[model samples]
Target: MKLLLITAIEEFEKDVINILKNSRLKAFSYQSVKGFKNDKNEMKNWFGKDDIAVDSLLFTVFSEYNCVDSIYKNINEFNSMQQTVPHIHIVTINLEDENFR
Candidate 1:
């Protein structure tokens, strides 16, 4: 198994979720988060307001490595077809083992 993590703009969460679901990749977890780029000072537009401080949607999914391609494709499509926005991090790692509640 493998783990996939994606951090993207908040407004895109719903679209991301839909894309994931449509891709037949279910059984995942997600949350909304507030964060900023390392060069926030350079991106003055993101400063001075709580609402515009930079918020993103984070999603975590555990699946076969092949699933990564589909997810990445979906995300890329979403970004290109929609308005360009915040930074995103896509982390994929092997899952040695697991326990769940």
Candidate 2:
């Protein structure tokens, strides 16, 4: 088994969920999170800030390797058709031991 972590801005929550469902992901968990970026140039706004915070979501999925691969493919297709900067990010970690009860 592997641990898949997917993160995206809240605005794309529905789309992300759809991707997971289409991938046949049986179970998963997600939570609201604050995403931060430290880009001085992009921070030059009316408030004159050095950083910015974005409302985001983090999804955790534990599944087999094939399932994880399917999710990655789906997310890549979704991101390619986007015309914005924020896109879904996915990472997978190898689980040394899969015993979880």
Candidate 3:
């Protein structure tokens, strides 16, 4: 199995979900989280109209490697279409049975 993790601004959560829905994966889990961004990032400090700028961390497991590949492609397409959006990070991890059991 493999784990697909997508981390991005809260505003992009729906876009990520839409991309996931179009993929072969069956389900996923996501939640809000607090994190700091570099001074050069769009979020900057936590004292403006955007507040703390919580991130939406979405993740799921793919039983097949192709699923991960497809999702990464979809995510890249999504990223390319946006110019003003903050940088999002996508990671795919291979999981071993021993790590869980």
Candidate 4:
């Protein structure tokens, strides 16, 4: 089992969720997170619109490694669909228990 952690703009949450669902991966956790970009003193837009700001954190678990690439690809496609560049972070980890909350 592995955990795929991603931090993205709040507006992209739904798109990410949909991609996960379509990828057939289940069970995840998320929270509203406030964070800034790597570049400070500069504001950027996702699709050249609203100013950059803190968004959401997306955490999901996958039981298989095979699904990783597909999940990422779908997310990239979704971001492109919205005419926005993908600004996501990915983390893979092994889990000791399924009951973790």
Global fold similarity of model 3 (TM-score): 0.72
Tens digit of per-residue lDDT, candidate 2, span 1-101: 88999888898899989988888878999999987767766623212234667788999999877788789988999889887777888889999997776
TM-score of each candidate structure, all chains considered together: 0.72, 0.85, 0.72, 0.65
Q: Across residues 27-96, which tens digit of lDDT does each residue of candidate 3 receive?
A: 7888777655545456443212353445555455454566777778888887787775464567777777
Residue 26 local lDDT, model 4: 55
What's the TM for model 4? 0.65
**Best candidate according to lDDT:** 2
The list of candidate 3 runs beyond 4 A from truth reads 38-55, 60-63, 98-101
Runs in model 2 deviating more than 4 A are 39-50
Ranking by lDDT: 2, 1, 3, 4
Candidate 1: tens digits of C-alpha lDDT, residues 5-55: 877677667777887787677588998877654564564433223444466
Return the lDDT, model 4, position 94: 73
List per-prediction Cα lDDT, in the order shown: 0.69, 0.81, 0.66, 0.64
Pick the winner on TM-score between candidates 1 and 4: 1
| lDDT of residue 90 for candidate 1 | 68
Give the root-mean-square deviation of each candidate in angstroms: 4.2, 4.6, 4.5, 4.5
